[model samples]
Target: MPDPHSSDAEPRPAHSAPSSLLSRIKALLRPAPPADREGIRAVLEAAHDHSILDGESYAMISGALEVADKTVADIMVSRSRMDLLDVSLSLTEQMRTIIETGHSRFPVYEGDRDNIIGVLLAKDLLLTLSDHALDIRALIRPPVFIPESKRLNELLHQFRISRNHLAIVIDEHGGICGLVTMEDVLEQIVGDIEDEFDDEDEKTIFRTGDNSWRAMGTTEIEDFNDVFHVQLPDEDYDTLNGWLAAELGHIPRRGEHFQSQGLTFTVVGADGKRARWLHVQRVSGASSSPETHTP
Candidate 1:
């Protein structure tokens, strides 16, 4: 009020260049903080553009932010795709499934798949090896049920506190819709993390016999072409499974087949939304020998 242009009238706070990324971000948002996700995104994009945050860190942080907005239903394995165990099955039969599926844990149901009673750990079955008198039900751990609408951030908190890796998702009417796992949540932040069961380098694509080969659905389109020496035209799609789904016009089911780009892709194994494994056969008369695509 005394002098509008005088520096002495109102001593302004010296805005020194922020030392750390956190300080820089705080400095950028100053008096008005981000209002919503989009506002936060704007601030993050600004930081990203200014080289305040590196590519990897920005991607992970952005993924974590995305997790907060998503619900369990977004990434959950659908109820139909869940590999559940039948409580009525004999121990021998259960062991077969455990061996085949390569899953560490399975949800055990009584009469119906919807009637999930508890979870069974594959390691727990080893207890029956030494002690033949142990009851099967005794090994079953209580199952956790979560609402599908529950935010992934809250679910992640619950997973951390309860140490429960898996939780059954239910609808508003208490109907089983799907299941979510800690791996699923973690993948959202850090991208895909491979386990022991995941396809290894050479194991990604295996030569079955003759002109047929077995390939994991996650196989990269480029890898597939490199192995078979054929151009599959990966313009929009990245993975073979993704491209197959688009060609089929829907999520491929086991036994369904699609022919494209001089190849026959048969869904050998599949879940609700994606193919797990595929049988690929060279339909065109390519000069490449079958031995070339081995492994």
Candidate 2:
């Protein structure tokens, strides 16, 4: 009989495999357990509870998962709020608008916002000032247009491949509805990303008295609740302004006051449509309610 372990033994057929190979084949024969969203969420929550992941990390993971179901329409800057430049305006005038907005880029339009021709990068305009003869149009980059319904994940991928920072969101009728930026998409994943323009010492909610506080319209509902030690419903809205809007059935204008959840929200500063700053005060001896609101 030949020694099976000996190299000198007759060579086995090509199809015959070693014992270690057979073990790997056995391992491959077993299928992995199927995983669903709920299972993944549970795992994440467990990790969070064990402190394997921080709260911010958990929130960002959840946001990343949530973004897959969101579209450009959800977080886009509405047309009314967009800072635009008219191509018909003189370079000096356009520079003034750019400086006032403190924006690095602006959509250039021929006649109106609807007639957007291209994007004008602020840095590109500097070169024009140095060389007065340079055509402003030559510096304009072709605008990227995306459908309002396009999923954010797909948009992010397009942004990566195209190297574009902003895209004009178009409605079904082929009209510009709003604009979305790379920052907007990333904000969803990593929470708010403040720029240099943001006030470093600005407080979202400032205590003015024993029970009175001045809060920014953009202050997150959770932060507001933590600061006031109140249980405010946050399921329907994220910001104080959004909650006020939902309560009032419309965006509250300046000088408007809405009472809800044992708190009185007074719009102290606002533009035509959205509230900018609000004065909040707790109603003495009043019980909190989830749905009760008075205008």
Candidate 3:
């Protein structure tokens, strides 16, 4: 009989490229039995030999496996970052405001952000604008309520089937919490998303100019270190807000001024007790300054 250990034992095509991914996958599947430490090593080695999988495919499989474990809280835009329509206004006012904000989809609320009634499409507003006062009640679409722990992939499918872009994410107590958009869901599949509504100029944290810097309050203390290249060591804070709070020892009111590490923080606009907005600038070299006053 012909030698069984000869070339006949290798049944694979001789012309196959050494880098052929299918050939490597076949190699990976060829292992037998207990698959102990050594066998596991072979699986990894075989995987390395093949380009059978790509980054996108790996992300998809990983996402599917971990999706249920992922929460809407993980993917939902924070309330501070949300662009929602305060539906307490008249329809005309709402439409005008939405136009100014440049957001096509908006969450509509009756009295407060916590009482979201439904979502309104910009197209619907245009249709109703012919009348003096567009009827917001009539233009409202049914709100899709999602828990903060809902899986993103499931929500994406829901968005497709229902043709809804905005979903109101609710907390366990049924309070209106955050908002998630179809774009937010898509960003999960891809990476960070840049859309028309997002201002390119506002993308960076601290933007410097002639004697002014517009910074997002959420910019990290470490980033503050990097941008100004300074070491302001306040042990208790990681955000400008935290720094301001620590300096003030209380929630700062509008027009309050505090100084630390050669920088001055002025509370520009505040909602009640919390500092909703701030103006930050390097303290000009001068004599001692008076307490800040608001206009």
**Of the candidates shown, which would achieve the greatest TM-score relative to the real structure?**
1
- The TM-score of predicted model 3 comes to 0.50
- Candidate 1 vs candidate 3: which has greater TM-score? 1
Lowest-sum lDDT 10-residue window in model 2:
193-202
> Candidate 2 — number of clashing residue pairs?
0
Off-target runs (Cα >4 Å) in candidate 1 are 1-31, 127-135, 205-215, 220-243, 251-295
RMSD of each: 9.8, 10.3, 11.2
TM-scores of the candidates are 0.66, 0.59, 0.50
- 51-162 in candidate 2: lDDT tens per residue? 9999999999988887898999998877766778888777866765565345677888887779989998888877568665555788889999999999999999999999
lDDT per residue (tens digit) for residues 1-295 in model 1: 4787887786655654444666878888886889899998888898999999988888899999999999999988777668788888777667655654556789999998899999998888875866555556888999999999999999999999999999999999999998888988988888766655566665687765677777878899998889877777689999988887776777877666676556777665565668877778878664432222111
lDDT of 3 by residue, 188-243 (tens): 55644544433535443433345545444455677777876667554778776676
What is the number of backbone collisions in each predicted candidate, taken in the order shown? 0, 0, 0
Q: How close is candidate 1 to the true structure, as a TM-score?
A: 0.66
Q: How far out, in Å, is residue 11 in model 2?
A: 26
Q: Global lDDT of each model?
A: 0.79, 0.79, 0.64
